[model samples]
Target: MFAILIKIKAMRVLRITFFLFINAFYANAQYDFEKYPSIEYKDYDWETVKSDDGVTHKVIVPDFYINSESLILKINYYTEEAKDSEIYISGIKYKEDIPYTPIGLSSLRIADVNGDGLKDIKIISYYMGNGLASLNVKVIYFFQQANGGFIKIAYEDKMGDNRLERDFDGDGNFEIITMKIQGHKNHNYWLFNIYNFVNGKIENVNSKENYPIMVQILNRETFKITSKLSRQEMKQYQVNNLENYNN
Candidate 1:
């Protein structure tokens, strides 16, 4: 009789614990959001700016591109002083803006690079030192789809000055346009590369200097490396109205 009574008590305790757990989860979820009361797409003014360590931040909303599949909004912003920065997104009628947790970024620009009608975000950050210094740390982060949430693609640390993304071969995917430096600003050149995503990894197909800065899509299963285009070469391409010569 004692054993049966003990079993009943254990069952009662388990039931109570389960009910408490569900109640707590629901309560927390309900209280997660603030009571803003209304939602609109208005630009937030510069929240803070100071000069002790020289911190500046500004946000501007550029254009809203509405396609048949998705609504792409471009956000342009910069931060001069702060350890952490945030970017917020919201719908035209929703009161809550979704804050994307940033990783290794301070300021950024969003645009549609390949004319695909999809927005890609680019971020640039400078490294902090002991005292004061002036240097630019540029990183190109591509936004891609994963499950239901969007993600930034480039994971390599500290990219260069300028970057362009396009389908270098005739394939339907995009690769990175990396500008490499030989020796600082004076002796550097640009190289356009072709990348292939295979086995869940980004790998380079073929990369060489002197390739045109233009967006060259893959065609007929291969892409050729053309002569390198200098900064002057880019000017000539533009002057002669040459297609696929330079960006």
Candidate 2:
């Protein structure tokens, strides 16, 4: 009887030890940006600028491109009086590039879009061809402070005119919306993409078809499909007044 009791206690200890081992391994397995292969930190031209909110930012434009069609922007964050934190953002051109005309960073905007009290970064960059074949891209990086550094939690990209963020659900959080003019210039239609921050990341909450001129209501919890206008029905409505449209 004594021997059996001792063996049972030993088995219980082994089970608890195994459980802890698994949890420790998983905690360390999370993505580490420093060790990531696709990201590299090299010498680059750095500029220091102060935003309207009085925060100092060190913008680093990489001297060389790790990938030909992509541009990496490494920004260091600082207080109104001191320089201290860092955030890295990158944008890639989807379409084939036109040779000789390199893509460049055109503009940058710093603001708090998510209502999370942290300042976010918005980049507007363009690639030019011979006037007709040019492409303009916009990228937004949302920041979250973790582990003594500011990390990019969400990213949204659009190959269109401009990027807009609004509180679509009236829930205090912002939703990123982008409008892309598809098809040829003569018979083109607008394609709108909506993204919401959910589950610690950005998620698409719209269908792939054209939506009608109706209010889109998103469920704040699930982030699942609630309702949207179908492509077939959207064709019947005509949008004549552009100024009245909610961007």
Candidate 3:
């Protein structure tokens, strides 16, 4: 009789949990996406910039850079001061205004980030407070268009221990691994944010994906991860894999 009673109680608990999950999902689904900001795009002549390079002295903020056969990036780097950068790709007549770069500039690279044949761009930059709690990390992506231009998307997360661009699954694709931490006074709640380019746009595709492969790769690579799961939790879980995440 006791066994039957325990089984009945277990079923009741499961039913309650199931209903709670369904209700939560419904509430989340009702949240309007219009409340959020759309993706940002940088308007410029990429063709000329792709084949240009040089140095110019500026009394103001300058386009300090890394050059490759396909692109000359002026990371628009600055710190402790507000400034604007004008990028004149070597001999090109056109100039584009790159936004004021953060003081937490980490690294930038060009590669086929979205699994597309064309090379894409990724930037990892972050700022922090005196303690572990104050983190403002940004992961930015510029998914290349077939016309040789790029679509820009930026995401924020707290855990940024692994700053290098890596294809954690070894499947010819790379993922932007970030995380979100909540709670007060170190009683933290973590959400793992896994991002990739899906159909020329950056999207979070955590569900319907093999997360273990990434965790295993990080373990093998010996990454120091604080927020174990990841960063921002989005409802639209995309499913795009990357390969050889490099520039």
Question: Model 2 over residues 1-247: C-alpha lDDT tens digits?
Answer: 9999999999999999998998777555421111212211132343546565433223544222323223345443334221243344553221211111123443455555565644444544343433433543434354433221233432223344323455555554565565444432243334445555555565654442233222222232121222354556444543322211211
Q: Of the candidates numbered 1 and 3, which has the greater lDDT value?
A: 3
List all candidate RMSDs to the true structure: 24.8, 19.5, 16.5
Which candidate has the highest TM-score of all? 3
lDDT of each: 0.37, 0.41, 0.44
Sort by lDDT, best first. 3, 2, 1
For residue 16, model 3's alpha carbon misses the true position, in angstroms, by 51
* Ten contiguous residues minimizing lDDT sum, candidate 3: 212-221
Q: Tens digit of lDDT per residue, candidate 3, span 216-246? A: 1221222222344442322322224322122
Q: Candidate 1 vs candidate 2: which has greater TM-score?
A: 2
Task: Quote each prediction's TM-score.
Answer: 0.34, 0.40, 0.46
- What are the clash counts of all predictions, listed in order? 8, 0, 17
TM match of model 1 to true structure = 0.34
Q: Candidate 3 regions off by >4 Å?
A: 1-68, 77-103, 163-171, 184-186, 210-247
Instruction: For model 2, give the RMSD to the true fold.
Output: 19.5
Q: What is the lDDT of candidate 2?
A: 0.41
Ranking by TM-score: 3, 2, 1
Cand. 3 Cα-lDDT: 0.44
